[model samples]
Target: MTGIAGVLAWIEEHLGIDAAKGGLADAVLRHVKERCAELRVSPQSFLALVERDTTEQEGLVRVVSVGHTWFMRDREQLELVVGRFAGRGPGAPVRIWVAGCATGEEAYSIVLLADARGIPVRVLATDLNERSLSFGARARYGAWTVRGLTAPEREKLATPSGLFEIPERLKSLVTFQRHNLVDPPPRGATGFDAIVCRNVLLYFTKPRALDALRRMRSVLAPGGAIVTAASDVLADGTPSSDSELPRALAKSPTAPPTPVVADLTPPAPWGAEPAPPTKAADAAPVSDAAPREAPAEDGHGAVERARSALDRGDVDEARDLLKAALERDPLSIEGYVLHGIACDASGNTYAAMASFRSALVLDPSLWIAELYLGLGHDRLGAKGDARRCLARGLELHAKAPGLASLSSATQAMLAEGRAHLVEAAAAKLASL
Candidate 1:
């Protein structure tokens, strides 16, 4: 039998939990089988030794139990927490807990953020596995864990080995311990300002999940909030309410709000006179035309400016100008679209999606807007939307040569996007 089947059988026997009942262990085990090979566990061979229940079995299980987390795991949630608690002044050495802190990425990130803000935070980082704790205590990290850090943050926080060097001055501010959330947390581990268990509790049964949450709540200060992965934090069983301190914070709504009516309309084309204003109800909606600024002097002219900056590889400058143009006039659909382009160039896919979505909301009939939105969605791993948008853009382009002709650079992007969606869809289907 495959190691996954063996694991399922072994878990059912020892934990007295049935995989047939659809427990967290079942999901975790499946993910473990898929990813185990990367982590160096031979899933196929591991299955053969299930009856042994030896040290290797425990080792295999621990590897499966530990989770993968990174700095800024949920980027928006990190921003919110930093804004809420760490932004506060040196107040009684603000306490925080990171449960199931495997490999210490999230815990270390919390430390870095708190220190950067000069908050007096005492962090208690814990995990159930001794080996995982040892790895964390060593403070060495891989490149992937440090991917999100800004250069300054990296310089100030992490050692050359990629671990945050716990400076003596801040040594008292953080502690690491090995504790299982399945048991009561160690004495004094509770009653903190915030508890971050993002992506961890999704591995437990509902009863286990509730118990762990209650433990998190028992020690949480009246207003303290628990942050979990967006996948696990649901409205049906959420811990936060409208007015109380949250036991858990649900994912913030990410969809754009309904578009508000505006007085503005797109500028008339180059040499034509201004079109007479039609009544609001009778006016034909504007296409994706943008607000025009008198072209900046001493630079490549308007049409070439964004392209020139992109060509010269001055990405930050391009992004800044695009952002400024958008802010100066929110009606600038071109500005919004280009800002999304700049964000994608700079490797901020999430921010790019937000920008693209904003552009489409301003002018839904815009094929370029739809095209770029599809590209952004594809890059962010949304294949279905990407395919639909690309097909839609092609349809519009067929109707009008002006609509169809993409810049060579954008054409290359479209090609790459198409390739990625096809590959992703195929892999997903094969897995099923």
Candidate 2:
């Protein structure tokens, strides 16, 4: 094998990471070069050391694996965990394992949520990287990690450092450990009440991923649930069997069931909308109103449902429902707008922009779409686009009727949008 190929093979065999399947081969090579430079060793020598030394192999895996995660990364799944155990009496401890916990944002988020809701729970957070576990133990994070938190939530749990430091109480609820999913369950990891393994399986080949899934399933307590990425669904578009968190574990060891996989894929924006049907040559064209009215009703219903899902912090469900709404009526302005909101909440800025742009295409009068589109652009660091869109939205809002005339939700959205716009402008000026 070529040198790079041989190294990649080693990574897969030892780390259970299929570099090519993970689309991270290039990144792994880059990390290898950086590591070699840091150690003052030749590439060949470094590779030899990694082969011979277990510690070096572990360090290499840590460097190659991306740990880009944040607090409340998937709010809906967190809510599910809370809802399940919050009301239970203290007879049995609510056990949760955050597999691939990556620096502890997800694990700590769970602990914080449980405390806020008065749930008595214990969290075991494990990852393959020892350095990441050490960082999690520190419980300090940059502001970007806590962006989704409300002011009250931030004040209650964090104190300001160069980066925010999580309160000791929250940190005390979780135990971080070094563990690998490709291996057997670590001691004391069995019978968890809930297991959260989001966004981790995509790193392996299908066979390896299945093996990891089976291992994860084996450790669950009877009726315990495992939550994963929504994209991990079955071919039929229904949530895979793994998503049934409340289902009782089967008696047979060989009958390993699937875990709940939450979908995080952004809904397709307006550009992918199907074209309208052509009119018959012999018949006069139908009035635009009749065709428009029917779809509008369907779209409105769907958007309303999406809004309800969002209210409950079920972002995946909201996005899925919005996708159906848009499919039913491509020109549904409200559907596109609501979909944009869901995408923004889920950290999908580009998709959010596309959804907002689609809404504007359907109705240029939608000031809300412009406002959200601007916020999305700002998050993506498109300063010029952000400024123009925000300016236009604000101008439109000023010309509209009194704020008392709008719905409470719309009022809230407008206020939040304005705040983001001002923040973006201030940031731009600070850089000058």
RMSD of each: 21.1, 15.9
lDDT of 2 by residue, 45-131 (tens): 777887888767765665444344577875655776677776688675577878777778889888888888888877887776665
Please, what is the whole-model Cα lDDT of each candidate in the order they appear? Answer: 0.52, 0.61
lDDT, candidate 1, 1-432, per-residue tens: 667777776653443223443133434464456556645768766666555645544443453344333465555556556556644655476667777676666777777677777776767777655555666766654433454577676566565433445465555455667565656645545456677775444334455556666666666654566665443422244532112323223234552121111112222211221122211110000011112344454322332476567555445456666655665567756666666766554444444567777877876665666665665555334678877776666555447524233345545534433433333233322322
C-alpha displacement of 339 in model 2, angstroms?
21
Query: CA shift at 377, candidate 1, in angstroms?
Result: 32
Pairs in clash, predicted candidate 2: 228-262, 229-262, 230-262, 230-263, 242-258, 242-259, 242-260, 243-260
Identify the leading candidate in terms of lDDT. Answer: 2
Per-residue lDDT value at 304 in model 1: 43
Off by over 4 Å in 2: 34-45, 160-162, 233-432
